[model samples]
Target: MQPGEPSARFVDIELEPGDLRLRTLVPADAPLLVEATSAEPGRSLWGPHPLGPHSLRDAQAALAEWDPAAPGQFSLGVLRDGRLLGAVGLIPERPGSIEVAYWLRPEERGKGIASRAVRAATLWARDGLAVPRIWLEIEPGNEPSLRLAERVGYRFEQRVPRHCRAWEHQDADRDTWHDCLIWTFGTGPA
Candidate 1:
């Protein structure tokens, strides 16, 4: 497990508490993914056009891109009683550290699910994967996510100007960039 190496250990594992489990997303979960991402907040966060998979085909195509065994990234679904609520993604950012991002069904927001899921994932990254550092890169205007990061015990580290740039999904004609706030979890070696 060298620094910045993706852990294959995440490929077939499930993090559990019974009430809410984090597991790998399967093709069968595409419909649920579409349902969760088809609404507000998710629509904006995940899209600007096509508005996040209007059909099963679209959702499955998107799901196909998530490779659990890929070199430096993986995504898991947040499930409660077999119902998909949202997803959490982990991407290696730099040596000895990884960045975590999450989103929930629009209707599921503010119920503390995000905090619990994040805590579980970070704990797994530290204890299960031996990752020494975990980070959350959030947009400055996303107040909900900022609060969620704090509730999950991440401390504000700094605000980075124009830390990210990307084309709007499926819309190469439009691209955007924004300032990001970096938050770090207080665990493992610093």
Candidate 2:
């Protein structure tokens, strides 16, 4: 959707008392976001992004679309004590489904941060946005991410070939699509 066009879906959410807050990404978070996403681990998963060189502009662009007056495919910074720990977002991937994606800094791993963030965002999509189905698609080899999805009650729905081409740089040719395990929350697993 165009910027400023009303989608009326994404909304701010608070996860933990004052320690963890899921809120709109801000320009100040650009540098940290760039640093996090540019790492080999993150880059391999999210593919190449412009955040490294054009941090401010990139962050602004990321947040610009989610104006309070108009919102769609909103991204949130997972903040702990006002410092960005990671990011989680909900993007409308189909007519009746919203997809979830998340990442945390290496230093932030193993702390349950990703789990909390994903859980909060999924609940917001379900209760706040009244979303009927939430999807979490994981690359077959991403064991940690898959485990996190299971922890949040998302059950395996299906496996699809060539489901995630954007997840890797080599896949840019579209000839190396990775198999993905689709998991769902609202729609019970088969």
Candidate 3:
């Protein structure tokens, strides 16, 4: 669906599976956002915007900028027992596709939280939004994210060179880029 479509309304929707609740992030989550992102600095570079919020004020600004109602694009807080664990974001890539990006707290990794959260979001995008393709762009060295993508049904597609602008090289006179492993959902292992 295109932006502003009637079915793009996802701002108020909440995906609750078992004890996990995926809901729209709010300003109140700034502290958790800062805390979670601070544990691993590189986690910020995985999103569409390589530079993620680092301070509470920055987190608040990031939360405020997230528009869940904007067709096929949204960031949802992954909460368990009302406490923020991480976030799952669906960013529109094209007319019928979206990219799924997620990150969990350091302590929350390896507990199946990311898998469940991704599955929930993917299901929503597939059934709720009628989105046909869902994909992920993971850095090659990020083993955890690579494993999680496969475990959640996203198959490795290809590696695109210079897919993302290096966050650390933003000020360099010459361009510096990084490769990203593309993984797409709804296909068997490659």
Per-model TM-score versus the true fold: 0.79, 0.78, 0.78
Clashes in predicted model 2: 0
Off by over 4 Å in 1: 1-7, 11-17, 44-50, 166-174, 186-190
Predictions in order: lDDT: 0.71, 0.68, 0.72
Decreasing lDDT order of the candidates: 3, 1, 2
| Candidate 2 Cα outliers beyond 4 Å, as residue runs | 1-10, 26-32, 35-41, 44-54, 64-71, 166-175, 188-190
lDDT by residue (tens digit), candidate 3, 1-190 = 7533634535433455457788767556778777767766454522434354467776776765665543445687788777778888877777677789888777788999889889888877777777778899998898999989989988889999878666565464565778999999844233
RMSD of each: 3.6, 4.2, 4.0
RMSD of 1: 3.6
What is the TM-score of candidate 3? 0.78
Q: Residue 189 deviation, candidate 1, in Å?
A: 9.4
C-alpha lDDT (0 to 100) for residue 17 of candidate 1: 48
Q: Over 4 Å off in model 3, which ranges?
A: 1-18, 38-40, 45-53, 70-72, 171-175, 186-190
Q: Write the per-residue lDDT of candidate 2 for residues 43-86, one digit (tens) a residue.
A: 41122454233355665565565343444466677877767777
| Candidate 3, run of 10 with poorest lDDT | 41-50
